[model samples]
Target: MISLLLVDDHPVVRDGLRGMYSADPRFEVVGEASNGAEGIAMAVALRPDVIIMDLRMPGSDGVSAIRALAERGIPSRILVLTTYDTDSDVVAAIEAGATGYLLKDSPREELFRATEAAAQGETALAPTVAARLLGRMRRPSGGGLSQREVEVLELIARGSTNREAARRLFISEATVKTHLLHAYTKLGVNDRAAAVATAFSRGYLSHDNNDE
Candidate 1:
């Protein structure tokens, strides 16, 4: 059976997931955690084949939990199951080491299959989430923000306009704009200021440079 650890803040959700997994002969609910902190502890102790993680929680939070589990060398594959599918949520969770992303709207069978795939260390993305990731992958930056895109954002963080950033980076202004656009898409921001702020918050840019 594919062993699973259910991690969500809501007890009702946990109960529902537990019931679903417990009913399936191919899977088992090995453990349940009500928050990200508890989830991390259970993950370490249980070492379930797959962890069904929620994106938000009261304490450690889902992204923090995923990053922590990966940092602490926990080998359990994490499959994010949440209601939110925004670029920030999906991108952050995947970058934090989740094996897959699935929305709560997904059919019960899809969730079951996603858990199975996650147990096998496969990528499982809901249709919309997959499209978002696919769009990011198709951008000039591709997947995560490219090195050039990050450099552009770093320059912008220092109050450099597109022309100035291009002059500094020795690239054409058009190229600089392209990089910023890609950064906007990848970082899920609408404008240059938001992009720069998000880049800093996500460590794409250094916070030490507070110059505006």
Candidate 2:
């Protein structure tokens, strides 16, 4: 069974999630938290495979909580559950280390699927969230990204698979992954879109930009 930690300030919200997920034989709710701080503490103690977190809380918001988890090197993946639909919130949550973000009104089945995907380290973003993330990429960054990261980010932005990037770079996929991981950490972003955003925001993708 995949253990899950549900964090939300609302008792009814948690209860609803618990009820829906409990129906699936492959999932079990290991714990619940009323705020980000409590969520972090309980997560360390339980070590659940996934955490369903809320963006807003009384103490230590979800972004801060996610950042804390990433800094601590916690292995559990996060799936953010928030009411906000703005691109900034979606991007910010992802940059803070959330593997996925779903609105509170997400269908029950989608929520379950997202949780499962997150447990396996696969990304699952709501359609709106995906749209917003893609929209952020439309803006030009004016060559603000770094050299090595630019190479990887452009390939990633072109929808090239990581395996393809490894082959093109004449490096092992693991090495490519290492570079991408470092890029992710240093860029304060996760997943390809955020990395691309960071790269463009830093002007690394511009043709006139070159740094070796």
TM of each candidate vs. truth = 0.67, 0.66
Clashes of 2: 8
The C-alpha lDDT values of all candidates are 0.88, 0.83
Candidate 2 ranges with C-alpha deviation above 4 Å: 143-212
Q: What are the clashing pairs of model 1? A: none
Best by lDDT: 1
Q: Which candidate gets the maximum TM-score versus the true structure?
A: 1
Instruction: Residues 179-202, candidate 2: write the lDDT tens digits.
Output: 788778777787877887667665
lDDT by residue (16-117, candidate 1, tens digit) is 999988988999898999899999999999999999999888868999999999999999999999999877899999999999999988999999889989
Name the lDDT value of residue 60 in candidate 1. Answer: 85
